[model samples]
Target: MIEPAARPRATAAWLLLALLAAAAYLLGLGGQHIPKNGDESVYMHIARLTAGTGQWLPLQSEIEGLARNTKPPLLFWQAMVAGSWGEAWSLWRLRLPSYLYTLASALLVGALAARLVARPGANDAPRPPLQVAALAVLVYLAFFSTYRYSRPYLTSAPETFWMFAPFFAIAWSPARVLGSRLGFPLLAGVALGIACLYKSFALVLPVALALGACYQVAGPRGRGLFVLRRAGFWSDVGRVLLAAIVATALFALWFVVDPAPAEVWREFVVGENAGKFNARESYLGKALAGSGSIWGLIPGYAVNAGLLMPVVVGLLFAAWRARSGADASERVLWLWLLVLLLVFMLPSQRSARYLVAAMPALAVLMVLHWPRIARGWFIATLLMALLATLFALNVALGVQALEPSAGGYSAGLWLWLLAMAAACVAGLVKDGWTRPVAALISAAFYVAFAWVTAPLEGPAGRYDDAVIERLRGEAVMVPSNFNGDFERYQFLLPGARIEHYFAAQPVDFDGLPALLAGHRFVIVQRRVGQPPCADERAEACRVVAARWDIRSRQTNAEIRASLLRAPQDFWFAREYLVERLAAAEGRP
Candidate 1:
């Protein structure tokens, strides 16, 4: 335990460390290498549309007749506000809010951990609460999912923060509320309401389950019977209900304010919410079918938690050992984890990102129970770390050997692996400090790993300013049959008017010539061994431009041919041809 006088200094040290961690996370955040994923493109499109139209209510999308109210308007509003920062919208500007949200969430994790550690009846032999809290923040930022999805223009980071914030507020409150102040409950309600506005009303499930578990363990109980006869218990229940009502009211404000209330109801409530659950062809349904069972989430959860899995397993074992003597906080933590897992499992569309809300509780529980974990568990965790470090080193060296040019990039990874291996060995050799040492090392390795791999987004490609400049005022046509590639092109070609034709349909091929006559440029896909143009009718479409290959290695004809021969074995290189149709046809 840290003395009260020393606590301030310890906290300051931890804050400095946390700030450093934040900087690592934010390194190259706005780099051009960070390509926009499909989700980011959709959100960016909607945000741009909102910014252009100035429609605060009944959120709209770039796609005509499509409403963007499937999720709440908060993220779009945030993106719109971020986009307004400069004259031109950029990826960094759009993703700024998510970065801030992620930082705030990390800080909140530390605060929550500190609060849980400071509670009465916490483990006597535990490390200082500040140390534990700092470790929790480190563990969270080190998570692979946190590195991947947290900084993107996504709802996971903000949603996780909002969901956990209310629990922290209520759980950290004084043991008893004697007056009618309703402070904690009101704070919880407001947080929950904002979360709902950020994403969906489904957030109510996890919050309710967590609060109920808190009540079960903390509320007064009679001998051999669970009773809620006390005034405080009833007051707590009423406050929770009030919170729910407040959230509902906030959620309903969209319908009342939107000029097209019917559109909001039909699109959001019926189409987005109910439709997702009912339609077997929806994304959720397809995921459930593809996964084979709900248990598919187990592996995903492990991967998302990253290096913390060993600690999680150890914590579980400790909880099982102390099940009979578990305190209110322990019960709440366990219930929170179980409830989050179960609720997410119920959804057809399950993702590791969805489980992020449970990470803070898991971090706190791991810290609270670290002192009780067996030596064997720590040894096993160390062994796992060692194996992981060795594997990373092998892969990095192998890649360097295969491609001499990649040696520069792989050197950093090799160094990180070496450092991780040393840390693991030190932890194994040390006594009474194995867990803390291992945790700190693991955190450092993950941070380094995220930093080294941040440049990997290069392969995903970005908007080519040269391409856009060349075809500034021209209309471009592309095949509508392909997947999300068109959407990406649409986003990149902001100034050019892009139209699509059903090239896959034989009946539409007859009209291809007429379509080409009207458009100056036509973007078409060309597979290896096939003619550059789709058919002889497209002979007038002479290739004038090609898609940019953003990968590290320059692709050649041999590689393209091989990928085309085994399309199922690999994602074939997509070479788009930008043809000047009118010029080829010798038209003025």
Candidate 2:
């Protein structure tokens, strides 16, 4: 068994690892492309409007000319910061907050792991070396979905951060109750309340807390309360509840006074959440979230984000030991993990990242099993990390073998391997803080690689950089064959009023002539369905598309359309849509 005397050093090592991992991400991965999912456009637009007008716009808008509004305004408020800063939002500015939240999450996860695995209140159970904490964080970052979706611009990024922050609060600082003295369980409530604003899944946290409380109050732990004859137990429960109420009130306040609150409420709360229970087309519905299958979410999460195989394999043997006789805190963490698993099970919508809130829990679980990890297994993991970094670097930098005669392994690969081997030998031999030093070096190397290579990988990031350099106009519209392209565009373009015209939306094409009549430049994707020109200038319209095909040179092509008569057709159509959408909600 690990000695208590070594605890502090171990804990320090993990902390160091977290810092190294975060530093790498900040420097190397900060400005990569964030895909423009459909919702991002809406959030980006709303934020621009909210920031500009300083008013909470209804969470309803015209999308490519269709009058539709769903989803809460919380994420919009996040993006609003980006929009309010200028005519066009800054990519770094808009995304930075999300990144920071993610980093905070990493810190929280490391701390929680230390709390769970370290001897509680021992103050000397050889605090987990910072290397262990760093390893946990690194393993988490390497996990697919959490790393991808944790970028600051995605609504998921904010939601994930807020949701997890409460778990951290519960694990690290349990006494900062917001309402106990004032009126209720305010501190806990506020943390949870903000999470509720971020997304619907946040509600699960309170449920978890309540269940935990119930278990404590009714089960074996209750003996303490009765024996003490001190009402602190009851008082603690009251404080927690009061905190919940305050948080609820704060979140509800956002919905209570707005002129269109009812509409926003119905669409966001009822339609977005409740409707998912019925509407198949809704985001969390069958198509998006895998609604009906018995093993839908778990498998999807595992495959999409690669969580299943690694985590499951790592923890398999420890399963019985973990569940049979673990401590209360360990049991609580297991419950927390279960709650996360169950929460996503029924949502008609399921994405790998939807389970991101589980990262901390998973991190803790892994650390619990670390002592039992065979030496061979540890070395294999290290080899994998090194390989991943090498492959990623090659992909990002277009590095190829120096000698054509050489197989996949080139001089660079051999050199890197040798350097890693030398480091590993040194780490193995060092008497003090060897693991911490090795982990630091490893995390730093990957971070540096991520920073240099991610920038040139996609057009969205490239365009964002280009736009920042050349801010000639108000908005930049990048044509997309698919909706995913926009996240990066939104992340990059900052505050530019974004308008999309897609072949997928024929009306956008039908109305294209009018949409571009006043605009000089239009960003178009390759596969976009071309609209027929109505006037003599039809021949002049240019077309530009990204050439992903090797023979085509993967270029972003643009076409210039000739001037046409100011079209009156689409204005009537748009106004008609606006009226129809307004009518659906009985809007004046």
How big is the positional error of residue 391 in model 1, measured in Å on the Cα after superposition?
Answer: 7.4
- Candidate 1: global Cα-lDDT? 0.63
Q: Which model scores highest in TM-score?
A: 1
Per-prediction TM-score, please? 0.77, 0.67
Error of 2 at 140 (Å): 4.1
Against the true structure, candidate 2 reaches a TM-score of 0.67
Error of 1 at 393 (Å): 6.7
Estimate candidate 2's alpha-carbon lDDT, on a 0 to 1 scale: 0.49
Q: Which ten residues in a row have the lowest lDDT in candidate 1?
A: 566-575
Q: Which ten residues in a row have the lowest lDDT in candidate 2?
A: 570-579
Mind giving the per-residue lDDT tens digits that candidate 1 earns over 1-588?
Answer: 567788778777766666677777666565533423446656666666667786676576655445577678887888877878224676667778888888788877787778777766676654566776787787777666776677878777788788887655544552452122477666777788888888888787777766655665664431124446544566556766777777777877777787888887788877776654545556555555666346677655555767666666777788788788766555666677777877777665676667777776676677677778776677777787787665445434433332233234646666777777787888888875576555665556555545443433333223357777766777788664432224445445657766666555211234545666676677654432233555555566666654322222223663465333432112222345446455766754
Q: Each model's C-alpha lDDT? A: 0.63, 0.49
